[model samples]
Target: MNEKVVVIYSGGMDSFTVLNRALKDGKQVYALSFDYGQRHVKELACAAKVCEELNVPHKVVDISAINQLLAGSSLTDDIEIPEGHYEEESMKSTVVPNRNMILLSLAVGYAVSVEASQVYYGAHSGDHAIYPDCRPEFVLKMNDVCKIANYDAVEIFSPYLEVSKTAILTDGLAMGLDYSNTWTCYNGREHACGKCGACVERLEAFRDNNTTDPLTYE
Candidate 1:
């Protein structure tokens, strides 16, 4: 049997790229998404669509139990979503506090269930200051931690950890990813709140890459 690779896919540009990379490398891809009381389910829906399009196995883990542990975040709360480009300061509240850790650990468990040794996440350097979990060092440490915790030789993969969001966008484009199918809003609003940190960052990256965005932005 070919090696199986699982991804912490959120149906975003970075996660989309990670999925492509795993598939292109001849691994059977399994995507793990969460319905973790997020402000919106659009991203998880998009994640399902992407997995179907790729003919990969998709798992929608109900992490609402864990999500309840989240507090003071626009993503999981009733707080207003902040709109702005990702800078050093404004992106702070966007942190879900160990969210990536929780998601990745869950993904690792899923991978082990299917005898997969590799797990992938789409965290990038662009998220370092804002999401501590996305930093390269954090990923490295998590890899080590998972190795010891699982004792099953599971290795975590993060292809974009040292790269920029623009690079992820570029890679997704090269892989023929239909970004129109992805959602990045902090709010589960009617339209892409073009002001949220994610939307703004995505818009800027696509623009910087001179790539046309497929998402509807107002």
Candidate 2:
């Protein structure tokens, strides 16, 4: 039997790229997205659409209560989503506390339940500065935890842990990924707010790659 892998998919550009990479690797892809009471449901919708288009099994776990319990981050709270480069200090307000950790923990359990050997996530170098959970160290430690916490060994496969966003975009383009179907705007408007940190970073990636972003911006 081919090794199966569970992808922590968010329907964002990075995670979408990771999903494609996993599919290209010939693994049975089970995508898991969380509806954690984030300010917008666009991402969830996009996730489903992407999965449907790719013919991949997808699950959206409802952990919206987590937002109420861990309120404060701009993503789950009423705070304004900051507009700046990802490296800006103000962008720290967007960090959902231990978000990747929580998501990966869930993914590990899902992987084990399905007897998958690997779990894939889209943590990249750009997120390491502000999001401690997205750093390589955290993923390595989490891999150890997964190995010990489960009867079967499940590896955390973060292919882009040290890769740049521009490089990721380049790979996605090579794979013919449709960027418009992926949602990255934190504001969750009908059109992307090009000023938000997520939007800025995505736009920068497209710019660096010398390609136009297919998504419309307000």
Candidate 3:
């Protein structure tokens, strides 16, 4: 039997690559997506669609009740989503409080229940500047906690932890992955607001890869 693993899929480009990578490694992937009252439901919708096409077991966990607790960030609150380069200081407003920790903790619990020994999330080098939870130090500490949190000792796997968005896109492209299924915009509007940090970074990644983004942007 293939090794069982849990993937924290957000329907974004990074997580999309992580999910497919896990499957390519011959793991039985159980994908978990959090509906934490983010600014938009577009990513969640994209996640569901991709999972369905891949025939992967996917679950969308609703943790929206804690939206108020995780407020202050533009992702879950009233703050304006910043427009600029991804690494700009202004993008800091997009950080949801303790988001990765909360999501990883819940993912660990799901891993325990499913007898999966590993959990993967798509926190890449691009997020290290603005999102503290996505930093290498945070992931290292989270891995330690994940190992001892339960009797099974699940391992936290972040394959793209030290890699850039371009590298991730390159990997996905090598695998013949269609990025159209992914969503990276922070806004819920009909089209992606290309000015937002997320959109800017995504476009940069595609540019770096010498390719075009499949999603339409405003």
Candidate 4:
């Protein structure tokens, strides 16, 4: 690819894989993470660390306004993050409505500012079951909307959208992604609760991929 790629990173297993995948393929990477007033500022901080460690240009956008607008989720509020397996019941509590859309919109703007035409994300199909915004149809629609909304110069690419967490983990391992450097807990604490929806998903991904999590959890 001749054009540069900017990633919408969240410092979770998914976005870390997306960032690594782009870099492994020799794409010039500019990692974009958000300080969106989320409950877990730890994840954003992790994103900054990983970006620096990987020698990628990383910028944090202040989107507290957007988070304020969408505040029903446990990820952004005092509500407890659901624990257990990543199933329909457990995942629903973690959904921040239209979160991917807002994140991608900001990422597209950044990509355009940097003269980059492609933006990458890690919205996979497993998440689609819980997050309405991560679905293929929603991504396609948002891509079209962003193309027009972004002066037709910006495009979004979701490389893992059709796969499972196990599949994305396979790519992450190959790209040498430091799992310890990334954070996934929805709880805003010093340690992984090891029980939140995201934590559960991460554990399952590691198990499914026959990998191990390096982070210490309670």
Candidate 5:
């Protein structure tokens, strides 16, 4: 039997790439999405659609109330999401405190319930500078914690940890993944706000790869 892996899928370019990679690796995939009351709940819809197309079982765990308590971050609150490259200092406002930790904790539990051996999420080098939870150290420590917390030994796998967004896009492209089905804008609109940090990074990635982003932007 192929090992089962649960993907913390957000229906963004990076997470969608992770999902496709797992499928290509012959793993039984279960997609896990969170409704954390983020401004970009639009990604959840895209996530479901992608899962449907892939014929993967998908579940959306509601932790939307976290937005009520963790209210300062731009993603979960009223603060304006900054526009610019992801390397900009202002983009730090977009970091939700302990977001990956919280999500991974929930994902680990789900993995255990499903008797899965691994949980995959997309936290690439691009996110390390601004988001503490996305750094390699955090992933290593979290994997250690998972080992101690679970009897069945679930592993946290981030294949893109040191990879660039452009490299991820290249991989997805090779797999024939449809980038149009993914959503990356933070604005939660019908069209992507091309100015937001997420959009900017995504656009740059495609441009660097000499390809066009399929999603229309405003």
Candidate 6:
């Protein structure tokens, strides 16, 4: 039997690539998504659609009940989503409080339940500046905690932890992945707002690769 791996898929470009990478590596993948009341459900929908196309087992865990506790960010609160490059300080408003840790904890629990030895997420270097939870130090410490958190000892695997968004996109494009199935805009609009930080980074990735983004934008 192939090794079982649980991928924390968010239906965004980064996680989409991670999900396909697991399959490409010959692992039995369980794609896990969360409904954390991020102001939009399009990413979850995108995740489900991609998983369906790949015939991967996908589960959308409803954790929206905790949205109140995780509020304050533009993603979960009434604050306006920031626009422009992600490196700008204003983009900090978009960071959901302890979001990655919460997601990783749940993914680890799911991994244990499924007897999967690994849990993959899409925390990349680009996020380290704006999102504290995606930083290398956090990942390393969380990895340590995950090791002894339970007897099963599931590993927190993040292949793009140190790579840039451009590199991630490169890998996905190399794998012949169609990015239209992914969602990156911070808002839950019918068309991607090309001005938001998330969209900027994603567009930059495609531009850096000298390819056009398949997703339409406003």
The TM-score measured for candidate 1 stands at 0.95
Instruction: Give the TM-scores of the predictions, in the order they appear.
Output: 0.95, 0.98, 0.98, 0.93, 0.98, 0.98
Give the per-residue lDDT of model 1 (tens digit) for 1-218.
77888888887767878888888788888888888888867888888988888789898988787756788777787777776766747668777878888888888888889989999888887888688788888899999998888759788888888989898888878877777888887777778878888888888899998977887767
Return the lDDT, model 6, position 153.
95
Return whichever of 2 and 3 wins on lDDT.
Answer: 3
lDDT of 6: 0.93
lDDT of each: 0.83, 0.91, 0.93, 0.84, 0.93, 0.93
**Candidate 6 residues 151-198, lDDT tens each?**
999889999999999999999999999999999999999999999999
TM-score head-to-head 1 vs 5, winner: 5
How far does residue 19 in candidate 5 sit from its true spot (Å)? 0.2
Whole-structure CA lDDT of model 5: 0.93
What candidate 1 gets wrong by more than 4 Å, as runs, is none
Candidate closer to the true structure by TM-score (higher is better), 1 or 3: 3
Residues 1-218 of candidate 2: C-alpha lDDT, one tens digit per residue: 67799999998999999999999889999999999888767998999999999899999999888776786899888898888988899999999888888889999999999999999989999988888999999999999988889789999999999998889999999999889889999988899999988898999999999999999988
lDDT of 2 at 183: 94
The residue pairs found clashing in candidate 3 are: none
Better of 4 and 6 by lDDT: 6
Model 6 scores a TM of: 0.98
Which run of 10 residues does model 4 get worst, by summed lDDT? 82-91
lDDT of 3: 0.93
Candidate 4's TM-score: 0.93
**Per-prediction backbone clash count:** 2, 0, 0, 0, 0, 0
**Residue by residue across 1-218, what tens digits does model 3's lDDT show?**
99999999999989999999999999999999999988877899999999999999999999999986766888888778888987888888888889889999999999999999999989999998889999999999999998998899999999999999999999999999999999899998889999998898899999999999999988
